[model samples]
Target: MLALFAVSLLWAFSFGLIKGELTGIPPALVAFIRLGFCFILFMPLALMAKKYRPNLRLVLLGSIQFGVMYLAYIASYQYLPGYLVAVFTIFTPLYVMLFDALLTKRFNAVLLLPVLLSILATAIIVFKMPDSGQVLTGFAILQLANLAFAFGQVAYKHYSVTLDSPHKVNMASMYLGAMLLTALAALPQTIGSDIVISQRQWAVLVYLGLIASGLGFFLWNLGARQVSAPLLAIMNNAYVPLAVLLALTLFNENADITRLAVGGGLIIISLYWAQQITQRLENKVD
Candidate 1:
């Protein structure tokens, strides 16, 4: 849970960071650079670890989760506001629940209440909607990205449990997978565009890749292992309030503090309610 909270803070700043710093950079290029940096940062430790063993399936999963998802996620910024990207991510918890149930073949209808609450909370925070075709496209793209990320999280939790491997070693492979896929995706842009980066952009990419993507992802997933599936799903929305707050403070974006406070409180209540429901259901089964 601490891991989730930590990553939520770490990831919350990212929307503003990318919008403020990396907006001029091609989104695909930004993604590729970040993934490359992440892979490089983990490679040395992965190589030195005596127990490191390559898992092809995990590599594939990570590619979908981080690599392809990053492509869609970063590109959406070209069409949509960063805050909306964060807002659309409210659906991720629902996707997480759905994917978990589909994979494990155990459906929990009660989880939907929390999922709906999460979305409603986000809607409260975002009182107005953009009725634009481009914004709609961005939302669609963001949802695809959300679904891919959620699938990866649930899949990794299920797969990583039996492994004795360290998270670093596993992450090394995952980041490498992201690097490869993003590299391929970025090739045309790399070849065609004479991309140049200011030192600030480079620094931001490094921070995002190393700190946010690298440590944040590892810790978030590690925390997932310690909690129930429903709880883990709820934690996915922990970033919503933090991101909104950061956007307001850092970007001077217009945000209603009252809405943020109320929405955030509702989100917490939803989590507690979901946990209680989960516990009662388990006790009934037992």
Candidate 2:
């Protein structure tokens, strides 16, 4: 849980960085560079580990989680406004719970309460109705991204428990998979394009690639492995309000302080409620 919170805080600045610094860059190119950094950071460690080999499952999981999710998410911006994208992302918590239930073949109705609360809280902070006539294409694309991300978290949490190797070893295979997918997606975008990156953009990309995408994801998955599905679901949205708050303060973006306070308070309550429910469940099992 601490890992999750830490990653949330770490990721809070990413929104501002991307929106502020990396605006003209192609999304696939950005994703490729980021995942490339992840691969570079983890692959060597994996190779040095004794008796290490690639895990196909982790590769596939990474492809879906990081690769597909990034592509789909970036593509959605073509059809939807940024605010709509944020609004649509609030559904991710529900998708997380749904995927977990489906994969585990156990649905605890009690856990749904916190998940719903988290969604409601996030919606309060970010939700805005679309003024455009048709946004179904973007909505579908964003949902696909959400589903991929949600499934990846649930699947990795369930699958990582059976692994005997260190998580970083497996992360190498995952990043490799992501790198391949994003590289393929970015190929056409970069070919014959006079893509000039400023020094500042390069620095931002490096930070996003190394710290946010690499370390942040590693910690988030580590935290996911330690928590229940419901808690994991709730934690999915925990960063939304924080990101908004950071944008308001640091980036000079205007936001409703009252909404932030109210929604943020509800998010905290949902987290507390989830912790209590999780403890009770563990006690029952014990």
Q: What is the TM-score of each candidate against the true structure?
A: 0.94, 0.97
Assess candidate 1 and give its TM-score to the true structure.
0.94
Q: Which has the greatest TM-score? A: 2
Runs in model 2 lying further than 4 Å from the true structure: none
Estimate the overall C-alpha local distance difference test score of candidate 2.
0.91
lDDT of 2 by residue, 101-153 (tens): 88889888899998899999999998878986558989999999999999988
Any residue pairs clashing in model 2, and if so which? Answer: none
Over 99-157, each residue of candidate 1 has an lDDT whose tens digit, in order, gives 99988999878778887787788778864767556888898899889998999989888
Q: Evaluate residue 66 in candidate 2 and report its C-alpha lDDT on the 0 to 100 scale.
A: 91
Instruction: State the number of backbone clashes in model 1.
Output: 0
